[model samples]
Target: MSQITSPPRKARQAPVPAAGPDDGARARRVSRLKRRLTPYGFLTPTGILLVILMVTPIIMVITYSLLDGVITNKNPAFIGFENYAEVLTDPVFFKAVRNTLVFTLTSVVVHFGIGLGFALMLNSPLLGDRIKGLFRVIYILPWLFTVAIVAVLWRLLLSPNGVINYLLGATGLTEGQTEWLANPSTALAAVTFINIWSGYPFFMISLLAGLQGIPRELYEAARVDGAGAWAQFRHVTLPQLRPIIISMALLDFIWTTQQFALIWMTTGGGPIDATEVLSTFTYKLAFTRYDFSVASASAVLVLLMSMVLAFFYVRHQKSRD
Candidate 1:
C-alpha cells in the first residue's frame, strides 16, 4: 500500500473545466432577449391592428376635425378649433345630443324592465319547459334578424294603411288609418318601441344566464325562513343579479345611443328630426352637407360622452365589487 502511494494520487485528476465568463454572459443575454421578444411576439398582431384600424382612424378624425371642409385632398389647412366652435354653437347638434340621450335612456330602461320580467317568467318552475323554450326562441329570433330587415318590416307595418293600422281598425280601436311613422310625436315613440323589441331579447338572454347561475339552495333557504316570493326576490335574486343588471344596462345604453341603422332605415331621422341621434346627425353633416370637419368634431363629442358614461359604469362596478 505504501509503495502504491495511491497510484500518484491518480495523477491528481485535473479540475473540471468551468463554463467561461463570456459563455455564461452570452447564455444570460440570449435568455433575456428571448424573454423580451416573447411578449412582443404575442402582442404584435393586436398592436398592429390597433395602430392600423383604431389609432390611425382616430388620428385621421382628429386631423380632419382641425381642418376646413375644402381641405379634403392635398395638404389640409388647419382652422384651429373652428369646427369645434361651429359644432358647439349649432342648435341642431344640441338637439341631436338631447335626442340621443333620451333615446338611449328610455330604451335601456324599458328593455331592462321587460327583459327582467321575461327572465323571471322563464326562470319560474310553473311554466312548461316546452313553452319556455318556444318563447325564448321567438324572442331571440328578432335579435338575429338583420337591422335592415327589421327596419323594413316595421316600416311596412307602420305605414298609413299598414297591417298595424288594419289590425287597429279591425279591433275598432282606431277610426281609420294611422300614419305612425309620419307624425313627429309618434315617430320617436314608434322607433323607441321597435328598438325595445329588437333589444330586449338580448337583455333577456343575458339576465336569464345570470338568474340560472344562482344556487337553488338560496331560494329554498329563503322560503324555509318564511320569506314570501316577492321578499325572496327582493332579498336574493335582485341582489345576486345586480352586477349583471348594471352591466347590461350600460351596454344597452351605449348600443342604443350609437344606433344608426334602424333609425336611418326606418325614419332617416325624419319627421322633423324627431328621432335624430348623434350618429345620424354626424352622418348628415359629413355626407349630406359635406362638412366633414364639423361631423368629426361632433363625432368626437359623442365619443367623449360615451367614454364618460363608460367610465362611470366601470367605476360603479368596481365600487360594488
Candidate 2:
C-alpha cells in the first residue's frame, strides 16, 4: 500500500487557454486568397473584350453559314447547311483547298529548314553578340513590314522590269527577264518563296529562344560521351527544340493557309487558280460574287480545319507529356 502511494502525484498542470477565433490566421488565409484571386480580377476586362470581339463574330459566322442570303438583306432565310453543300460541291473550293494545303505545307517546311539553319548559325560561336543582334534585326525586318506593303514591294521586285529581273539579267542568271508572279508555272512558287522569306524569321527567333534555354551542361556531357557536332545536334539540339518546332510549325500552317494579301496583290489567284486559297476564295465569294452565306460557310470550313489541326497537335503534346 505504501509503495503504491509512494509515487508523488504530479501537480495538476493548468489547462491551456483555447484559441480565440484565430482571427490572425483567418486574416492571413483571406489575404492569401485575395492574392491568388487578384490576377483573374485583372483579366476580367480582357476576357469580356475577347468574348465580344472574337466569340461574338464566330457565333455570327456560324449563324450566317446556315442562311442563304447576303448580309445586306433584311431577312436572311435559313437554308440549313445548303450553303455548306454548295461550298463542298464547288470545284473552285476543292482547288482552293488543294492550293492552300500545298502552299502551307511547302512554305512551313522550307521555313523550318531555313529558320533552323539561321538559329544554328546565330547560336554558333562564329558570331559575336553585336553581329548576332544585327542579323536578328535584319532577318525580322521583312516580317515586321505590313503584309500589304510587303506584297506591293515584292510585286515591284518580281515584276518583269523590276530590280530583281534586272539583276538576274545582269548576273546572267536568266536568259531574259522573268515574271515571278504572272506565269501560272511560277506564281505559286513565287508567292511561297516570298511568304517563306517573310515568315521564317519568326521560326528562327522562336527556335533561338529554345536553344538559349537549353543547358550548356548537356552539350558538355554529350561531348564527354564522344558526341560530335552532328551527334550533339541530332540528340541534344533537336530533341530540345522539338516542342518549339512543332508549335511554330502548327501556327505557321494555320496562318499561311489563310494568306490572302500576298497572293491577292501579287497574283490575284493568278493566270489560273494556282494561288487560290480558302481566304482569297472566301473573299471573292463574299465581295466579288456577293455570296455572303457561301463565304461564311467556307470560313466555317477553314475554322473547322484549323480546329482539327489544333486538336491533333494538342493530343500529340499531351501524349508526349
Candidate 3:
C-alpha cells in the first residue's frame, strides 16, 4: 500500500535557461541604433525636398548658363563663358546694375534713418505706453500690407489724376498730369519711394526690439557723467545698437537687391528700362525674350553677387557669436 510507489516519482523537470548576456547586449545595441537613426529619419524628408527643389534647380541653371539655346533647342551647344561675357558687356546689364544699386542703397539708408528715428521716439521714457502703442500700430500698418497690395495701392496713388496727382495739382506742386510710373525720369524714383515706404517698418520693428533690450544702466551712467541727450545717444544708444544696425542693413541690402515683385508690378521695368533691376532683366530674358541660356547666366551672376553679401553676413554673425 505504501506501495503507491510514491505516485510514480515525478519526472525531473529541466530548469528554464536564464537570458544570456549576448541577448541583453543585442537589445542594447538595437536601442542605441534606433537613437542614432531617429534624427536622420526625421530629416530625410526635408533633405529630399531641398535636393529636389533647390539643389536640382541650381545645378540645372548652372548647366544652362554654360550652354546655348537651352529650352529652345533639343541639343544645346556648349558655349562656355560666352554667355557670361555677353551679359557682362551688355549696356543694359550695366544699367540694371546701376538701378539696382540706387534702389537698394537708397532704400536701405532711408529705411535705417526712418526706422531709427521711430524706434527712438517709441523708446523714449517721455512717451506714454498708450501713445507708444498707438504709434506702433500706425507705423506697422505699411508692413501689414502684402507686396502685391503695396504695389497696387501705390500704382493707384501715383496714377494720372489719382489722389496724389489731385493733391499735387491743388498744391501746384507739378504742372500737368505727371505719369509717375510711366515717365522715365520719375519711374525709378517712384519705385524707390514705394519700396522705402513698404520696407521701413521691418527695420523699425527690429530696431525697436533692440532698443528695448539695451541696458538702462548705461543711459543712467551717461547722464551721471554730464552727458547731454545728443552725447548720450551717440555714445550709448548708437554703440549699443550698432550690431543690430549692421546686421539689419546687410540683410536689407541682400533682400532689396533681389526685389522683383514690387518693381515688376509697379512698373514692369518699363519706361525704357528706367526701373529695370537685375531681377527684371533676368526675367525679361528668360520669359519675355525666350533667352533662357543668357537669363541663366544673368541669374548665376546675381547669385554670385548675393553670395558675396551672404559671406559677409555670415562672417559678421560668427564674429558676433
Best by lDDT: 3
Q: List the residue pairs that clash in candidate 2.
A: none
lDDT of 1 at 197: 86
For 251-281, candidate 3 gives per-residue lDDT tens digits of: 9999999999999999999889999999999
- Which candidate tops TM-score? 3
**Deviation in angstroms for 228 in model 3?**
1.0
Global lDDT for candidate 2?
A: 0.89
TM-score each candidate: 0.89, 0.84, 0.91
- Candidate 2 has a TM-score of 0.84
TM-score of candidate 3 relative to the true fold: 0.91
lDDT of 1 at 287: 94
Off by over 4 Å in 1: 1-17, 20-29, 70-75, 316-321
lDDT of 3: 0.96
For candidate 1, the 10 contiguous residues with the lowest summed lDDT are 1-10
Off by over 4 Å in 3: 1-37
